[model samples]
Target: MSPSLKAATAVGVLLLATACGSSNGSGSDASGLNPPDLKAQEKLGKTEGEVNLIAWAGYVEDGANNPDVDWVSDFEKETGCQVNTKTAASSDEMVSLMKTGQYDAVSASGDASLRLIASGDAAPVNTDLTPNYADVFEGLKNKDWNTVNDVAYGVPHGRGANLLMYNTEKVKPAPTSWSAVFDKGSEYKGKVTAYDSPIYIADAALYLMATQPDLGIKNPYALDRKQFDASVALLKEQNANIGEYWSDYLKEISAFKSGDSVVGTTWQVIVNAAKAEKAPVEAVLPEEGATGWSDTWMLSAKAEHPNCAYKWMDWIISPEVNAQVAEYFGEAPSNARSCELTADKDHCATYHASDEAYWKNVHYWTTPISQCIDGRTDTQCVPYAEWVQAWTGIKG
Candidate 1:
């Protein structure tokens, strides 16, 4: 992959989010949180001869980065739609790119999907129009971050967990829990790392969910000020031993390869990238479970080539392409059938793509809103804005 393009990935997409709210004037209503009422594509039209896209780096590959990784060329050939892509560096950049309406579609993660929907930048998807949608796993459908009032906004592309990756030689006994990066992070002091985003507060919250039950954090995303403060406090303490925070997966890979980062949050692709270069590294889903992302391919509200966009969505998620992208990108394919097509027969198994038991503990990213998503009506949870504010303070 090209060095610049390689910087973009689902993980760099920050696996991020917005505050989801239930109506009480500030949140949701009887129907659900209100999204800008926009019409979804009801029927297919003739291809416009081209489509433009905003996607994470590893997606929308057309062999420009690596010959073996081409997926977009065949799509253009079969659908007669030339593909133009823009690689976004962060979840915020994606949301900003989508707002321009110059692109027809984007591969959006939970963190950015809600903002797109709420802003009317992303249109609702008629999944029926995409035949391949039927093969997608049920778990990734109509999720809180991607849906509103049960309305499906996009199609699932792929998913993965933020794991505890460590240098096998430096860390002994194979730590099984997040404590390695939290409670015991001081052991590595200058070598410890964490994701460089506010959502990381949830990692601290997830650890507290298991070890500090007194904090009363039922769901990581749904935290009141007290629970939120506690999580931030833990992060502040952790910051003392922090080596650096990473938003780019490549940087994280480089850190691990150099022994500069011995333990911290990472994605499977980073582990694979480091391993390919002969780095002695391995990732584990610690006993406390973990946080994750299931990104979606959402159509633009004012898409200039709606038909081509629809065709592209269906083509990308088709089994063989999905498998190729998943293997090359290092995440689980959303299509259940794609597992059969991966070059490495163990790809899905290695990533736990179909292991429900393994995923049950994995909390997918969501925007923390004023109304608590965890069913707590008595108190308001800290919204995403506060999360941003606290994150700035934590880093300061």
Candidate 2:
């Protein structure tokens, strides 16, 4: 599908999902699992002396990479909340860490947000307490991944799509469809790469949604047994031609630079890094659409530093800070105002931060559930736990 056509179709889906209240439900009245009885903080109070966080590596920078990249220090100084961060490499790890109840906040991706919400590991955010919440993009607010039953669970962080990256010199005609890495993967046999996670199953599910309409696969994350099996089957087939599945940026960049990977799924940041190394590569959002992520800065349900956590959430999404984080993280800023504050004037444009149409075909990752996120009551859908096992099986 052309970008415009995909966007138009996405707009329709978005409208339907919004009107229905929960993406898991069809328009009739499907709802998410009831949130546990956890109370949201009613008011902001005195800042605690310390705040510990669980986050993605780039989400919470203390200037360890470069002297000019410090946002945590300034936040700490302003609020007197000494910052301590523990980086989590995957959503499952974040979930496990949050369950320990040792952290104050987490930058939860879409896949883990619902699990946290459903398990009561995360508390509903009082947007009124976070002043910067107003500046976040309207399109990001109240989505299925961040909000439950019309209640906000976290502050919207940055977002980006998983793109198709190909070795420009080796792949002729510049492939525009996901099939180059799926259905036609044999063409690049033993040279194709993919994400190294169970969540990646959604990528195949997304492709199946576009290629095999007979499956009735509505949402990539919301797959029943039949659809889920079909997606897994496709992955098993692709696995035959896989060179290496990647979970880290540097690893994939190295693989591409060495010509071990010729084509596969990738992130914009990975593409930028590869090109910087002078590797002949290009990335695109294929016609079949793609799975993406929208992260949320969520407060722990048992937070001991509620006041400081609230302060951090508001500060992180503020114009200047958001711009810095978005640019460093290579994603579209959640705050619309952050675009103007970005050092590179073209940062927002390059990531399509403000382009709602472009995001239409980009399906943000959401946790799958038995209630059927796509609104099918006739069959139970596979959950994330099952996906983990399936991933192990496929990789084994």
Maximum-lDDT candidate = 1
For model 1, state the Cα shift of residue 261 in Å. Answer: 1.7
After the best TM-score superposition of candidate 2, give how far the Cα of residue 244 lies from its true spot, in angstroms. 0.7
TM-score of decoy 2: 0.91
Each model's TM-score? Answer: 0.91, 0.91
lDDT tens per residue, model 2, 116-214: 899999998999999989988887888878877778899998888889999998888899999999878999999999988788888888889889999
Look at candidate 2 and tell me the lDDT of residue 120: 94
Looking at model 1, report the run of 10 residues with the lowest lDDT sum.
21-30
lDDT of 2: 0.80
Q: For each candidate in the order shown, give its overall lDDT on alpha carbons.
A: 0.81, 0.80
lDDT of 2 at 343: 79
- Report the error of model 2 at residue 40, Å: 1.7
